[model samples]
Target: MSGSQALKADALDFAGDTATYALSLFVIGASLRTRALASLIKGASLAAIAIAVLGMTVLRVMNGAPPEAATMGVVGFLALSANVASVLILLRWRDGDSNVRSVWLCSRNDAIGNVGVIVAGGVVALTGTAWPDLLVAALLAGLFLKSASAITLQALRELNTTGASHATPVESSS
Candidate 1:
């Protein structure tokens, strides 16, 4: 591929990833406002797992003799599944706190990552090259890591705030 072509491809991948991430964030925020956070996260987590599994099956069937497709498929599925499961498990608490919020963020981010993987698979199946698939997989991994870290930090902040609020006793001037 020419330099310009490579750059264009990279730009497209980044744009797609960003769009998916933004959509997921919007959905999550909307869910938080309109529905219970716990339920939203749980439902998203389940959906993500299902999507990952479906992607894997598609890849397996499409992946012919070359091992690259199969390998990428497995990695994509595992990464997505693991990320979703981790977030769900971490946010098992019903008391909507920083920890739970953080987990929800992670789940939301992973859902985007899952979409990226599926897109990458489609690109690979069409182009029959490993580079696009690899690029997307790597990008997905980075997104997951970045989102997970942010979620963790946010959770800590929520925890601290909750603690402070609970620690302060109500002042009554009788």
Candidate 2:
């Protein structure tokens, strides 16, 4: 809602998260392979979100936009608190399936990103520059990339294992 570049990027991140969680919910109870597929989708979505944030940061840098530091801090705090709650709720389901794991990972990454935003807000306030906000946005993007890669790898492994087990016929006992 805020026109500040950082806040806008943060909003986009939240929107992406909402979509990711919704997808995860739909696939939570699916088969192992299906869950793995969902995880892959989530990973791709995370990567897309990161790329989008980075792109927005670059554009803001080019345009020399300075976000309102106080607003950034306030929003960051609120977002962090919300993400912490989401993470706590998803923590138990983290090891359940690929879909659930992806949900947990997304929530965890969001919390960390929110902290970065808060720090960026403080730095921006002190320096009166947009660099801190851009830096934080980039860092958050990197975090998203890291989590996406990890989730995707795990999902691929699960898919392979699940597929192989199904394909291999069990030996009959004498």
Writing each residue's lDDT as its tens digit, candidate 1 over 56-86 gives: 4345345433224444445556656766675
Candidate 1 clash figure, as a count: 0
The numbered model that scores best in lDDT is 2
Instruction: Tell me each candidate's TM-score.
Output: 0.40, 0.89
How would you encode candidate 2's per-residue C-alpha lDDT over 134-170 as one tens digit per residue?
8888888888899889899999999999989889688
Where does the lowest 10-residue lDDT sum fall in candidate 1? 1-10
Question: On a 0 to 1 TM-score scale, where does candidate 1 land against the true structure?
Answer: 0.40
In model 2, what is the error at residue 117, expressed in angstroms?
Answer: 1.3
